[model samples]
Target: MKRRKFLKNSSLSTAGIFSASLLASCETDKKPQVVNKMIKPIVIATWDVLNATNKAWQVLNNAGTALDAVEQGVMIEEADINNQSVGKGGRPDRDGNVTLDACIMDKDSNCGAVLYLKNIVHPISVARKVMEETPHVMLAGKGAELFAYQKGFKKENLLTEKSKAEWLEWKKTSKYQPVINIENHDTIGMLAIDSKGDIAGACTTSGMAYKIGGRVGDSPIIGAGLFVDNEVGGATATGVGEEVVRTVGSFLIVELMRQGKTPQEACEEGVKRIISKNNEKLDFQIGFIAINKKGETGGYCIQPGFTYRVYSEQGHINKTASSYISS
Candidate 1:
């Protein structure tokens, strides 16, 4: 009986070993999971920028670098005399000066910015020159304007009759009201991943309509207005600059993506970070747009009328982002 018992135990042990070996073989044969496979050649931007996305897609489709694509794309908007929120048509500050702010970032982490730069119809291009030709990362006011002129950037009268007329009307009350969803202060912050899967970004704005003179928003501040990490992703912001600057919103989104959050999740969290510190009602608007290395994109805002544009092989579309307050 004892021998029979030992034989039974040995048979059970043999069966267990066979099962273990079979399981190991099956596991070894299984395919490794791939997360968020890379989708090359995509572009995203804040607000209704169909033309800008099309311009960017034109470059990416032609095998241009991400830096060149983003820089060129926003230039279209920057040059648009009808775009009152940026560049040529941007509304003036309280002092009736058309000060533009812009920044650019390349895949290699090189960045450049210009603030309170007046008479430049394409501050985005000037910012690019700063990134490419100068030793400094930022130049402001008269210095920035002089650098732009030195780089052969022609000074132009950016304020248009339409914007100037509005400024005159605004001076009537001189009220310091910042209207959410107005689109008057809409900034064009753009991101692109080229066919090579490298990422770059640009943000350009006339700044908030009727903002105090000499006030610099997040639009031209690296890490606050825009951030790019070739191994991770890139992010850009629009809306009120102070709130975005306070939270380091664009950088926060990229870091969140590095920690494995989806682009949409990262954008949502960035907006929430602002809400978390609030002691009063949210009467202002703030928006963020992000794209991961995988070419997946996402956006979120504090208020409605926040939309982002996308152009890829999948086609161009303007998507309204989910807002924190509406939720």
Candidate 2:
């Protein structure tokens, strides 16, 4: 009987030891699997995208929101010296006049835009204000400038010596008829999602080089050239001013996402819609990029070499330059 009691006690002791070991193993595994509840840093960027990557890193590291980073980054592109086709020194259209416009949107709040504005150096800032302060979604032309002026925005000489020289040369070539038809003007657009997973976008341009005074392209059209929806992500486009204006490419991309397409597929569908139309002979190339909530991103251009930049949570910011050298 004593022997039996000893065997039972030993067995119980062994089982208890095994149970403790199992519990210790579970505790060890649980430490690593704590659901990674740590907050991620913010992310932001603009399409200027080359060294702008560092700027995005700076903003994210500092805890700036994704929208703040994107707008700031695009502002950098607008202010770039050699960007020639966007803001300040942009190429003119057939006319010698210069106009400017910009737009920005945040998917987080479902509120944002600036449209058909002129003489305003920083349309995106105005757009953010309109979204945040005023009840309206868009402000345009003189009214836009008036609002900007009232808000203490200082206007500068939008026309630069280089742009003027180009205008004069074209005028000389056309005997100042103001009917020189040159194509291939470009613009700037940026779309981004930060580590925090919020989305934002901006588009800016000096009006089509020599476009008629007060002419506005898709650049300032909210859904036309730029759009952001946190549920899906965001998108922005540039190139072929008129075609982009007419097709509403940016909103179309979001709608494509609504229809269950990937960001790249949505971009392709938007481009296809522009191409398959039998009605219009589009003069310039249009290019766009999109990022969905899943972090799947895609871009397309109707022109052969169309490309844009991208910055996201998983990848560092980089420019993917492209154009439509062909059809």
Candidate 3:
């Protein structure tokens, strides 16, 4: 009986130790859970509502960070000469040179850019370099190209045969079209949120067709074309370059959030503000897309029959063709 009782006591002690170890492990796991709950997740937004945002959304959903997603999405626009007015056969300046510009920013680091670049196959990469490597906020024209080349960026002949043909045709006909220049002011504006919950934005464009020699649009202008703040989200603008620049369109929309306006409200109000002040010819239109920290988004266009593409959670590469109903 004594031996049996001793064995029973030994078993009870072993079980008690195991229970204690299990309890300790459970507590260890709980600590991380508690910490994770305290961390805030990131949100993102882009212009063009669902259509443009969708590309970046897919990248983020695939575990890409917001910056990477934004660049990838912007590349889609750059390569799509047929779809976007920013590059390739879309348009060229009076001299028939394709001057391209792009800029990107990450709210997590407060990085920003303004690049007046030319002959760059990937202006977005140059903008990224400005945000990451240099102390300066902008690089312009040939200077920007030189900087990019120094960074080991290879030169790409941005002009396609189709683009050349268009320019040659323009030289031949040079028809003076009236107001409402439909041929100019179309590019891709994109923003996104990564799985890690960071916000980023990018804008890319080949400047308006028949623009002045050496003209650079607002695409590379940080506040005018693209602006991002992880704290607030991001915004990007498209349309008449001069109008967008003068309005400081993208930053203005984001700033509205600082004043307690929703993303959609901000975008609408920004467009309204521009329209109210500008007395210029009415043919050119303007628009913007944005996302806020809450994952709410907004898009607005000043021109009729304006539509945009978006990539998002509910929508993957959704191209929503919309009309600008006069308010």
Candidate 4:
């Protein structure tokens, strides 16, 4: 009886030890869940693009990804005939061609762009396809249009009657200059952070009024017109494309944010960089808008009267950005 009792106790102890060891092993194998501590999802864009921001807010409010939000948001402006700087009604190049340039960057560093693409009203969508469907980052001119066609994009004349009439009148002077006034703002660049904390950006424009036919601006260039680091944040440039491209403006603001600058500070530094490079009269304008990883936003411009629109859980409003020239 004593031996049997001792054996029973030994078995129970062994079982208990085994259970404890198994529990320890399970505990060691389990990983802590990585929940994203998301701030309020926000959408920001250059100029008074409230409609576009609200469209983006619609996506974010529905838990859509940042990439989708930016794409859908900008498509509104692209289809709007009154917004001549962006899509269907954009002014023509010197040869009376209505060319569009656009670029999109998503969280994983994936990007796509189309430069000098004609006849496609929604170049932002085309850029997204170039990101997802193709191995190339950019397609240009006729090649871009062909790619759009192959991808089932409808080909329609992008030049509206109003734009064509304006182009015809512009031919009288044949004088070429980049216009900086609000009515003639050049690029519609947008950035967003989603509910999952992912970042994305898109920039689109018709090149400056009466620009050379073959000229491409910062709009379709990834680091120049728009840049998103995902882990850091995103930045975009509006106004003069050449100066922005020369300094890789958008990328610079993002890097500055990574190095601990607030979005506002980074944008101010960006405008300063452009100023440092140009000694000539600052007749042209440049605006840099930045959003950091925390959803903090800022905008700085080379000239006064620049504006930006913001939409978030807090609210939606249009605010004038402080300028290097004056406010």
Each model's TM-score? 0.86, 0.76, 0.78, 0.87
lDDT per residue for candidate 3 within 1-327, as digits (tens), equals: 699999999999999999999999998877432222322223233334343355565667678787887777676666665643664455667776777878888756445454546667777778788778889777778888898999887887777777778778877786643223555667677766665556777778886777777666678888888888778867887777778888888889999987888877888887877787775335677878788776666777677655555555444443343434554
Best by TM-score: 4
Candidate 2: residue 33 Cα off by (Å): 19
TM-score of candidate 2 to 2 decimals? 0.76
What stretches of model 4 exceed 4 Å from their correct place? Answer: 1-38, 176-183
lDDT of 2 by residue, 189-223 (tens): 66665666666777777755665565677777878
Against the reference, the lDDT scores of all candidates come to: 0.91, 0.67, 0.70, 0.91
| Candidate 2, lDDT over the whole model | 0.67
- Name the TM-score of candidate 3: 0.78
CA RMSD per model (angstroms): 10.2, 12.9, 12.9, 9.1
Q: Give the Å shift of residue 324 in candidate 4.
A: 0.7
Model 3 segments more than 4 A misplaced: 1-55, 112-114, 175-180, 279-281, 317-327
Q: Give the higher-lDDT candidate: 3 or 4.
A: 4
- Residue by residue across 1-327, what tens digits does model 1's lDDT show? 699999999999999999999999999999976544466799999999888989999999999999999999999999999888989988988878999999999999999999999998999999999999989999999999999899898989988999999999888876655434345658999999988788999999999888778988999999999999999999999988989999999999999999999999999999999888775358788899999999899999988889999999989989999988643
